[model samples]
Target: MEIHKKFAHSILLLFVVLATSQYSCQAQNSPQDYVDAHNAARAQVQVGPIAWDDNVAAFAQSYANQRIGDCNLVHSGNKQYGENIAWGTDLTGQAAVDMWVSEKPNYDYSSNSCVGGSQCLHYTQVVWRNSVRLGCASVQCSNGSWFVTCNYDPPGNYIDQRPY
Candidate 1:
């Protein structure tokens, strides 16, 4: 009898935890917002020689701060924006907010050159293209809010490929 009671209590606790987690996910988040956060975060964490999924959902929640629960993906305060990573497409905010290197084009892997020479270029392209199923968020309500800034490593482009 004692074992049965313990099992019941354990199950009850598990149920409560699941319910609370789901409620938390919905309370402060919308579907699009969740998708955005997951994608962006996945990119950031993915480059560190390790692949992670646990933090993806949490990373996607911040976009909820800018959106309303309406199905149209509009936000109550459209003044704010969310940015995503290169391979992310969950539509958290606008493409303008992303922390990408603007000087390079998004069409190819050259925009995001790889480390230790261009060997990673082809591989990066494949990975990037394959991971773009999330699609883009088509809104930029945070117009002119960001102070555009850029930094380039002068001596870094030591390769022989230059338009002379």
Candidate 2:
């Protein structure tokens, strides 16, 4: 009986450790988190890095806040800045940026287009060489999903211009 109890306690402790590790692996939604992820992705394509902008972030935050009720992936309709929006369960800033970067394989620099009608705007916007400012925000909605948005100054996805 004593050996059985010890084995059970060890198993429980192992499970707890594993659970905590998994939770901690999830990224947080911080401004720096967003910037770091974006910079890393941009570096891969030799594009210049972008700095955080308070005004841009404020705009992003306001837009993100507005979606707390529905967490919809709607644009703010502001033409002055380039934008990207994402919705998911417990989404983090870094995770959202990673999701955008994942589209890299679909983007063809020579053609300056996404392959086979696939979506690559988000990826292009991230590494847009001329987009020097970036602001982002993330909010957890009433329905428990997360909404994330990032805005870029001088937006990237132009009709005939390449992102890099």
Candidate 3:
């Protein structure tokens, strides 16, 4: 009886773990997921939180949908919006945002530049004070990789301006 109870408990625990992992993975790609990830990073630097815009999301979704064939990392060329893009196998929207936020260490707020010329534009854009809106999209490509993108309004990363 004791052995049976222990086996049942183990099976239950494993089931719970698997269920939780699956749900989290599925939840990582929504618009709210993207906004929450971005806001969390922005909050760390005392920057104001941004809101979601349907128009912006539509634009992002359209661009992401277009890349379903090749999953290439190309800018939308809108110039009206700031953009950050990422591509990887099994990439999720939250994962892409996390990857961008990982560049925080490379950014120098005092110097207003990336240290050693490392790529920190994505990080800077996430925390840009004047960028009051955000939209993001994730699409699975024909090659089995994922493409993710986030667009910011009023843009960021001006030639001589500080992000915050």
Candidate 4:
């Protein structure tokens, strides 16, 4: 029984090692690979194996240099998402210009009527269209290729944000 248990533990450890190595190899993209991914995204292509831009110092430097005058780049870290690259420093603000990658138009406008400046029931209006590349919003990271969705508006109404 003791020998059997030891053998099982060794197999498990080997499997773990193999799995970790494979994942790391796949996740580590070369600097050129990062540039290619960024270019594809600039051309409105959503390629997979998204580069999350975690500890890629070289990639970050190259991306910043490449998009110098094209975007207002910002490096930000999220506790849950780890280190990430963002565009338009205040891209979360109301006046921020973002890219809407959805296929249709999406609208969100809401107002609450005030009587004598008193608080009233809150009312909200949310509208959207159903189509490919319509109602979705996306923002490219400073890393160049990765995109995060900003579903607040459609593609046409907001500023044309791009990676270039």
Tens-place lDDT digits, model 3, residues 1-164: 99999999999999999998656655798878888999999999899999998888889999999999999999889898999999998688999999999999999989888999899999999999999998888888999788998999979989889887
- TM-score of each model, paired residue for residue: 0.23, 0.84, 0.85, 0.25
Query: Candidate 1's residue-wise lDDT over 1-164, tens digit each?
Result: 99999999999999999998655533423335434543453355352111223233333334432332222333223112122322222322323223342322322334445444423321232223223333222222243121211111111222333211
Best by lDDT: 3
Weakest lDDT window of 10 consecutive positions for candidate 1: 146-155
Query: Candidate 2 lDDT, tens digit per residue, 40-146?
Result: 99999888789999999999999999999999889999998999999898687888899999999999988888999999999999999999999999888999888
Q: CA lDDT of 73 in candidate 2?
A: 87
List pairs with backbone clashes in candidate 3.
Answer: none
Query: What TM-score does candidate 3 get on C-alpha atoms?
Result: 0.85
- Model 2: per-residue Cα lDDT at residue 145: 80
Q: Local error of candidate 4 at 124, Å? A: 29
Residue 9, model 1: Cα distance from true site in angstroms: 0.2
lDDT-best of 2 and 4: 2
**CA lDDT of 71 in candidate 4?**
57
Off by over 4 Å in 2: 1-27
lDDT of prediction 4: 0.31
How many clashes does the backbone of model 1 have?
2
Regions more than 4 Å wrong, model 4: 1-12, 15-26, 45-164
- What's the lDDT for residue 152 in model 4? 15
